[model samples]
Every structure is written in structure tokens, then in C-alpha cells.
Target: MAKETKNFVLRLDAQTMEAIEKWAEDEFRSVNGQILYILCEALKKSKRLPKTKNEPTKSNT
Candidate 1:
């Protein structure tokens, strides 16, 4: 099966971009992939990702 992909444009400072590039190289992934992987992991860790259709409602005081 073929893998799906998407494109996006992200802005960062030169130093931060450089660091991400280096990390991507170390992990044998493209910079974009590394960034996505990191964000997915972070969201999973924080339990704020993969949102459901119905979010909880706030009580009206």
C-alpha cells in the first residue's frame, strides 16, 4: 500500500530550524516527519489529541 502525505508551511527561526534538521538526520526522518512525530507524541502524552466529535459543554452559571 502507498503511504498518504500532506503538505504544510511552518515558520521558525534559523537556529530552531537548524536544530530540527539535525534531529531529523539523527532519527533518519525528514524534518517534516520529525516535527509531526514529535507533535503527535506530545498531544498523546498530554491527552489533548485525537479529539472526539462531541466536546464536553461548560455549565452556564
Candidate 2:
């Protein structure tokens, strides 16, 4: 099954948008994908991203 996503409006200044656009292009990702990647990374860094059953937990060697 595919994950469901919600849509909403976000407001950003021109400079910020431009920067994101450039970063997205450099990484070969659409702006939306880039934004999602960034958000997921932030969540993971803060240990706030919920883990799905299928996701494997990191094991210390």
C-alpha cells in the first residue's frame, strides 16, 4: 500500500525559493521531493520520525 499525503499551502520569500530550486536541480530532485527529503532528514535527526514496521532498525556492530 502507498502512503497517503496531505496538501497545503506554504509561503516563502523569493530568495529562499530560488535557493531551494537550485539545490533541487543540483540533486536531480523536484522541488517537492527536495523539500520532503529535507523535512524527513530533520525529523530523523531529532528522533521524531515514526518508524514503520517494515523499516529496519539500525544495529550496532
Candidate 3:
């Protein structure tokens, strides 16, 4: 599959940047990937994530 991605500038203080670096290293993900994964997971868990562009979502009765 082709990669789905968008580039956006985000502002973070030094400490937050440091933390993200450490966490990304610990989780074996690049910093950008870690942030994207985290946001995706959060949206999924919150039921705010949509089905894939090609997939239909079933509504609960």
C-alpha cells in the first residue's frame, strides 16, 4: 500500500521535544511515526477515527 501522510509544522517546547525523542527511541519508531501512530490510536480509541477511504463502516443498531 502507498503511504498516507501529510506534513504539518508543530510547535513544542524543548522538554516536550526531548520526551518525544526518548519515547520514540524506546518504542523503536521515528519521532514522526511515533506521533502519527499515537494520534491514530487515540482517535480509534475515542471512536473518532473513520473507516479507511476504501472501506465502508457499519453502523451499530
Candidate 4:
């Protein structure tokens, strides 16, 4: 099954939005895609992203 996504309004300063637009253009991604990528990376860095069913759990030695 495909995952469901929620949509909501996001307010951003003009400077921040401009930066994101430039970044997204360089990376060939839409603003929404760029935002999702950033959020996923941050979650992974914080070890807060949930493990998918296909991922194996780590074993402590």
C-alpha cells in the first residue's frame, strides 16, 4: 500500500523561501520535495525516524 501524506500551510520568511527555491532548483526538486528531503535527513540524524518493515533491527553485541 502507498503511504498517505498530510498537507498543511507552512509560513516562511521571504529570505528563507528564496534560499530554498534556489536549492531546490539546483537539486532538480520541487520545493515540497526539498522540504521532505530535509525533514527526513533531520529525523535520521536525530535517530527519530521509524524503521520500516523492510528494515532489519540492529542487534547489540
Which is the better candidate, 1 or 4, if ranked by TM-score?
A: 4
The segments of candidate 2 whose C-alpha lies over 4 angstroms from its true place after superposition are: 55-61
* Model 1 spans > 4 angstroms off: 1-6, 51-61
| Steric clash pairs (candidate 3) | none
Per-residue lDDT of model 3, residues 1-61, tens digit only: 9979778899999999899899999999999988888899999899898777666656632
lDDT of 4 by residue, 1-61 (tens): 9989999999999999999999999999999999999999999899899987776777632
Give each model a TM-score. 0.67, 0.85, 0.75, 0.88
- On TM-score, the leading prediction is 4
Return the clash pairs for model 2, or none: none
Residue-level lDDT for 31 in candidate 1: 89
lDDT of 1 by residue, 1-61 (tens): 9959877788999999999999999999998889999998899789889654575545532
**Model 2, position 21: C-alpha lDDT score:** 97
Alpha-carbon lDDT, every model: 0.86, 0.93, 0.87, 0.93
> Which regions in candidate 3 have their CA more than 4 angstroms from the true location?
53-61
Which ten contiguous residues of candidate 2 have the minimum total lDDT? 52-61
lDDT of 2 by residue, 1-61 (tens): 9989999999999999999999999999999999999999999999899987777878722
